[model samples]
Target: MLDWLYDIVGRILVWIHTGLTFIGFDTDSGWAWGLSIVLLTVLMRLLMVPLFVKQMNTQRKMQDIQPKIMKLRERYKHDKERLQRESMKLYQESGTNPIMGCLPLLLQMPVFFSLFSVLRSVAEGNARYGFDEELVESARAALIFEAPIAAQFNSSPEELLELGASDPIMAKVIIAIACVLMGTTTFLTMRQSIKRSISQMPDNPMMQTQKIMMYMAPLFGLFGLMMPVGVLVYWVTSNVWTMGQQHFLYRNQPVAGAAQTKNEGNGSAKGMLSRKKVAETTPEPKEQPKIERKQPKKQSRAKRTGGGSR
Candidate 1:
C-alpha cells in the first residue's frame, strides 16, 4: 500500500532534481538537493492550501460555538456521556467537525515518512522506490558544503567526530541552524494558535490540551538532530510556510475572540465619539430668577381694610 506512495514521492523528488540539473545546478552538489527539498515543501504546501482553509473554517466554527459548548459542559457536568452527546449534536448542528483541523497535518505524515525513507535509502547506497541507481548515487554525492545532504546526527560520537573532521564548519552550522529554526517556528506557530483560542475562551477545557501541545510541539525539533539534513531542510521550510499561512489566515479570517475583541474596541471608539458630539451640540441649563411678591400681597390687604372703613 505504501509502496505506491513511496514511488510517487520518489518520482517527484527525482523530477525536481532533474529540473535543477537542467537549470545548471550540479547534480552532485548540495545546493541542488537542498533547493529540490525546498521546492517540494512549497509545492506540497500549495496543494494543501484548500485543506488549510477548511481547517481554518472548522476552527472558526468551533470558536464561534464555544459559549454553547461551555454551557453544555456546565449543565452536564455530572453526566460525561450526555455531555459528549450534546457536544456532538452541537457540532452537527453547526456543520462543523473539530477533527477536520488535523486533516492537513495528518496528510503530510505519509509524505514526510516517505521522503525520509528515500533519503535514508540513498544515503545507504540502496536505490529503492522509483529512484534509479544513478539518481541515488547523485543524491548521495550531493553536499550542502562538505557534509552530504543526507547526513544525520544519529551516528555515534566517534563517527560524528570523523564527520566533523571530514566536513567543513559551515556544514555543521547549517544543520544546527536548520534544527533551531524548525523548533522555533514550531513553537511560535503553536503558541499563536493557542493564544488566539485562549483569548476567545480562556477557561475552556480544550485550552488546557492546547497549552500542553504548544510546549510539546517544539520538542519535535530535537528529533531534527536524528533526521537527514535534507529532511530537516524540508521540515524547516514547511514550518516557515505554516507560520506565514497561519498569520495570513488569522488576520483575514479572525476567530471569534479576535473578532469580538476588535468589535469591542470599535464600540468603545464610537461611544467616545458620541459623547464628544453630545458635549459639543447640547445647550447648558440657565438659573431661574428669584421674584419678591410678598410686599405686593401685604399692600393689597392694607388697601382692602382702609376701603372697608371708608
Candidate 2:
C-alpha cells in the first residue's frame, strides 16, 4: 500500500514538474533543476500563506500576553493552583494559543520531506523508474540539457565511485562547487530566519533554541551535500526561494508580537497602581473553620458557688 501510494504521489509530482517544464521553465541546463526547486518552494509557501497568517496572529497574542503572564506569576508566587487557574483564564480570555504558531511548521514538514524524496529521485536520473508514462514523456521533453547532473550520477555505483576516484580534476571541482553552494544556501536560509526570530525575542529560552538551530541546520545541510550534486542544486535553489518568501512575509506581515515597542512619555506608575489597587480591593471570601467549641460547665458551678457565698 505504501509503495502504491508513493508511486501515485511520485507520478503526480512528475506531472507537475513536466507541466512546469513545458511552460518555459526547462532551460536544458543545470539551472533547470534549480529553477524547478525554486518553483516548488514558492508554490508550497504560497499554499502555506494562510497558515502563516494564523501563526503570526497567535505569536503576537502570546507576545502581548507575556508581560501580563509574568505579572500573574509574580502575583501568584507560592500558589500553584492559583497560578494554573489564572494562566488558563488568561489564555481563554485572550483567545491566544501558543500551539497554533507551531502548527504551520508541523503541516509543512511532511510536504518538505516528500519534495526532498521526489527531487532526489528526479536528480538521480530515475525519472523513467519513478514517473508515469505521460509524465516520463514530459520529463524527457523538458530536458533543457542533454547532459544534466542527473545523467552524470546515473552511472552504476561502482562506476560512479571509479569516476570520482579517477575522474578529471574539473569534474570533482564542479561537484565540490555544487556541494558548497548547496550547503551555503541552506545555512544562509536558516541563519536569516533565526536572525529575524532572535531579533524579535528578548533574550529568552526560545531565542536560545533558535540560535542552536541556526548552527545545526547548516551542519545538517553539509551532510545533505554528500548526496548527488543534482540534489545539491535542487536544495540550493529551494533554500534561495525559501529565503525570498521569508523575507517577503517578514517584511509585510512580519512575525506576531514583534512590533517595535513604543515608549510611553509618562511613567507607567499610574497603570501599575490601578491594577494593584484592583487586585487588593477584590474581596476573597474567608473560609470558616470546620471545628466547633463548647463552653465549660465549670463556669456555671463557679457562678452558683459565688452566689451562695455572698
Candidate 3:
C-alpha cells in the first residue's frame, strides 16, 4: 500500500549514494553509504520543515487556549450540554480542532515507515525499489566504524562474521555508543518541550507527560539494541535534527503565555500568583456573553432607561 512512498525513499537513498560516488567516494565505502543515511535524515527533515513548524505552532495554540478551556468548564459546570456546545464553539473560533493536534504526526508516520522499509531492503540485499544488485551489494558491505550499517547490537555471531566485524565486542560497543547518543538526544528533545510548557503553564498536567518521557529516554536506548545500526543512526540523527530545528523555530515564535510570566523569571515566583493573575486578567471576548436574558429585551424603553419615549 505504501509502495509509492517506499519508491521515493529508495530513490533518494540511491541518489545520495550515486552523488557521493560521483564525488570520488568509493561505491562500497561504508562511510559513504552511512553518510548517505545521515544525509537522508537531514534532507527528509528539511522537506518537512513546514509540518514541523505547524506541529509546534499547533501545540502552542493548544496551550494558549488552556485558560479558555478552563473558563468554559467553570461557566458551564452545571450544564453538560452547554459545556460541550461552548467548547466546540470556542475551538471553532480559535481555528483549532482537538483532532488537528495529531494531524502532523499522522502525516509523518508514512515517511518514516517508508524509509525504514528501504533500509530493510538494503540489509537483506533484496535489490528492488530503485536499487540494483550492485548497489544493494555495496550497501550490504557498507560499514560505519567496526559494525556494518546493516548490523545491530543483538545480531547473531554468524551475522557479525558475515558483515566483516571480526571482533563481536567492538560491534556492540559502537552500537552502544549510538544508542547512548539516541537516549541523550531523546531526553534533550523532551526537555526542550518541557521547558516550553513550564514557561507557559508550570502546573500543567502535560508537564507530567514530558517528565515521564525524560525518564524513559534511557529505556529507548535499550530498545535500540533491536534496531539496525543504520536505523539507529537514522533515529539519533532525526532526534538531533528535531532538537536543533525546534530550538531554531521556537526561538522566533512567541511562547503561548510569555507576557503573563515575562517578569516571573525562571519560575522564581513559584507560579501560583502568576497563574491566578492570568486567570483574573484574561477577559472573555465581548461577542460571547456568558448568559442570555429574554425579558430585558422584551421590556419597553420605559423600563430600560426608567423613562418613557414618544
Candidate 4:
C-alpha cells in the first residue's frame, strides 16, 4: 500500500516537472529551476490551503477542549479503553480531529521525496547520446549550484568514485554547508511547531516523542548532501518553505488551546498579584488613644475609704 502511494506520488511529480519543462520554466539555468521549485512548493501549499486552515482551526479547538479532556482522563484513570472512547466522544462533540492537523505535513513528505528523486535522476544522467547533449550537460551542471562547493568537487559521481577522499576538501566543505542549512532549517521549523504545541500537551511519553522528532528530523536531513547538490537544494528550499508557511499560519491564526488559555490566566493572575502588592505596600492610618476620667476613678476609692473611717 505504501509502495503504491509512493508510485502514484512519483508519477504526479514527473507530470508536474514535465509540464514545467515544456513551459520553459525548468531550464539550464539554476535560477529557473530554483524558481520553479519555489513556485511549485507554493502552488502545492496553496492547493491545500483550505485543508491547512481547517487543520489549524481544529487544532485550536482541540486545545480549547483540553481542560475537559484532562478531566475525562482523571475520571477514567483506571480504564484506558474508556479514556480512549471518551476522548473520541469529546472530539466528536467538538467537531475537532487531532489527526487532521497532521495531514498537510504527512502529505508533504511524498511530494518532497518525489522532487528529490526527479532532481537526482536528472543530475545523474549522462549527456553523451542526445542531439541536445549540450542542453542536458548544461542542465546537469546547473542542477548543482555553481557554489564554491560544486566548483571544488568532482562534478560527476564517476569522478567522486575515482578521486581520493582526502583530495576534495572544497567539495566536501560545500556539501557540508548545504547539509547543515538543510538540517538547520528543518530543525528550526520542527522546533517552532513543537514549541507552539508543548503547552497543550501534558508531560508524558508523547511529549518525549515530539522532542525526538524535533531533533531527529534535522539529523536525518543532514544526510541529504550525499545524494546530490540538486537534491540538497530541493530539500533546503522545501525546509525554508515549510518554515515560512508555518510562520504565516501561526501569526495569522495560532493554535489556541492550552497556550492561549494559560497566557490569559497568567495575565489575570499577574493583575491580581499586582493589586495585592499595591495593597501590601500602601500605608495604613494610625489610631489615636482616648483619655478617661482619671480623677473620678482615683477619688472614688480614697473618698470612700475616708468616709468609712470617719
Candidate 5:
C-alpha cells in the first residue's frame, strides 16, 4: 500500500542528493548523502508549513475553549448524549476541531515509515524504487562520520560488513551517538509543551498521562538502535525543526494570556451560557390596545332635563 509513497520519498531524497553533487559535493561521499537527507527534511517541512500552522491554530483554539469543555463535562456528567451534543455545538461555535490539532502530526507518520523503508532498501542494494546501479553504489559506499548512512547499532557484524562499514565498532559508536542526539532533541521538544500543558490546566484529566508519557517518550531513542543512521538523522533534524517552530509560534503563551484564560474559564463557555440564559428568561414586549375618551355632549343635559319633567 505504501510502496508508491516510498518511491516518491526515494526520488525526493535522490533529487536532493543530486543537487548536492551539482554543488561540488562528492556524490559517493557518505556526508553528501547525509546532507541530502537533511535537505530532504527541510524541503518536506517547508512544504508542510501551512499544515503545521493550521495545526498550531487548532491547538490554540482547543486550549482557548478548554475551560468551557471542562464545564460541559461537569454539567452533563450523567447525560453522555447531552455532553456530546453540547460539546460538538461548542466546537462549532468556536470554529474549532480538537481532533485536527493531532491530524497534521498523524499525517506525517506515513512519510516517516516510507523514508525508513527507502533507506532500508538502499542498504539491501535495491535500486528499483528511485536509484540506478551507479546511485546505489554511490550511496552504499558513502560514509559520513566514519559510518555508512545505513549503519545500525543493532545490526550484526556480518550485516554491518555487508553494508560496507569498514569498521563495525566505529559504525556502532556513530549510530549510538546519533541515537543519543535523537533522544535529547525529542526530550527538549517535549519540555516546553509539558510545561505549558501543566500551567494552562493543572487539573487537566490528561495531565498525569501526559507527564508519564513525556518521560517515556524519549525512550523511543532506544529504538534508534534498529534504524539506519539516515533515518536517525531525519528524526533528529525533524525534532529540531519542531522545537524552533514551537518556540516561534508560542513565544507569548503560558503566561499573561493563559492567566487570563484560567481566571475566565476561557470566557467562551461562560459567555455562551450567559447569552442563552438571558435569551431564555427575558420577556418580549407586547403592544397594549390604545384608548381615547371624549367629554359628554350638550345633548345629554337636554335629555336629562326632559326626563325630570316627565
Candidate 6:
C-alpha cells in the first residue's frame, strides 16, 4: 500500500541530490545529502502548514468549548456512556474534532518512515525503495563531511574509530553535534508548545500530557545517536520549523482562553481609565447654607391677637 509513497519520497530526495550535484556540491560530499535532507524537511513542513492551521483551529475550538464539556461531565458524572455521547455531540455541533490536533504529526509519520527506508536502502548500497542504480551509487558514496551520509552511530566502535582516523575527528564531532542539536531543538519546540498551552488554559488536563512530553522529548536526541547524521539533520530542521510555526500561531491566532483573557484585560483597563477620567472632569456638589428660625415669631402673633380682642 505504501510502496508508492516510498517511491514518491525517494524520487524527491534523488531529485534534490541531483540538483545539488549540479550546483557544485560534489556527488560524494555529505553536505549535498545533508542539505537535501534539510530541503526535504522544509518542503514537508510547508506542505503540512494547512493541516497545522486546522489543528490550531481545532484546538481553539476545543478550548472554547471546555466549559461546556465540564458542565456535561458534571451532569453525566454517573453515566459514562451518556457523557461520551454528549461530548461527541458537542464536538460535532462545534465542528471540532479533538483528534484533529494530531493530524499534522500523524501525516508526517509515513514520510519519516519513507525517508528512513530510502536512507537505509542507500546505506546498504541497494537500488531498492524506488532509487535507480545510479542514484543509489551516488547516495552510497555521499559524505556528510567526514562521515558517510548513511553512517550510523550504531556502527561498531572500531569501525567508527577507523572512519574517525580517516577524517581527523570530523566524523565523531559532526555526529555528536547533530545529535545534540536535534535533541535541544526538540526540547525547545515542546517547551514552547507547553508554554503556549499553559498561557491559554492553565488548568487544562492536557497540560499534564504536555508536561510529560517536555521531559520525554529531549530524550529523542539520544535516539538520534543511533540514526544517521543525515537523518539527525532532517530531525533538527523539522524541529526548528515547528518551533517557528508554533511561535507564529501563538502570536497571531492564540488559543481561545488566552485570547479571551487578553480581551478581558484590555476591557478592564479601559473601564478603569474611563472611570478615572469621569472623576477628574465632573464637578463636586456645592454645600447648602444653614437657616435659623426666629423664636419671637410665636409671641408677636399672640400679642397682636390680644390687642385686636381689647
Best by lDDT: 5
**Per-residue accuracy of model 6 over 1-310 as CA lDDT, tens digit each:** 7778888988898888889999898876667878889999999999999999998888778877888999998999999999999999999999999888888889888988888777877777678766778777676666666676776876665555433325635677778788888888988988997787777567787788889989888788789878876677788889999999988877888666667898999999999999999999999889889898768545676576777464
Model 2 C-alpha lDDT per residue in residues 192-211, reported as the tens digit of each score: 87776565556445787777
Which of candidates 1 and 4 reaches a greater TM-score? 1
TM-score of 1: 0.81
Runs of candidate 1 exceeding 4 Å displacement: 156-170, 267-310
TM-score of each: 0.81, 0.61, 0.77, 0.65, 0.80, 0.81
Candidate 3 — what's its lDDT? Answer: 0.81
Query: Poorest 10 consecutive residues of model 4 by lDDT?
Result: 145-154
When 2 and 4 are scored with TM-score, the better candidate is 4
Which should have the higher TM-score, number 3 or number 5? 5
Error of 4 at 100 (Å): 0.9
Better of 2 and 6 by lDDT: 6
lDDT of each: 0.81, 0.60, 0.81, 0.64, 0.84, 0.81
CA lDDT, candidate 1, residue 48: 97
Per-residue error at 185 for model 6, in Å? 1.1
Better of 2 and 3 by lDDT: 3
Candidate 1: tens digits of C-alpha lDDT, residues 1-310? 6878878888898899899999898887778888998999899999999999998888778877888988998899999999999999999999999889899999989989988988887777787877788887777777765666777766544443443325545556667777888888888888987877676567776777788888887688789988988888888888889989988987888766567888999999999999999999998878789886656434576576777464
- For candidate 5, lDDT tens digit of each residue in 1-310? 8899899999988898998899999989987899899888888888887887787677677777889999999899999999999999999999998777677678778878988998888888888568888898888887878778876788898888877888989989998988999988988878877786666557778888877878887798899988988999999999999888778867744444666767688587889999999999999779998888887665776576787464
| Tens-place lDDT digits, model 3, residues 203-266 | 5766787688788977889888878888888888888888888788778876746755665666
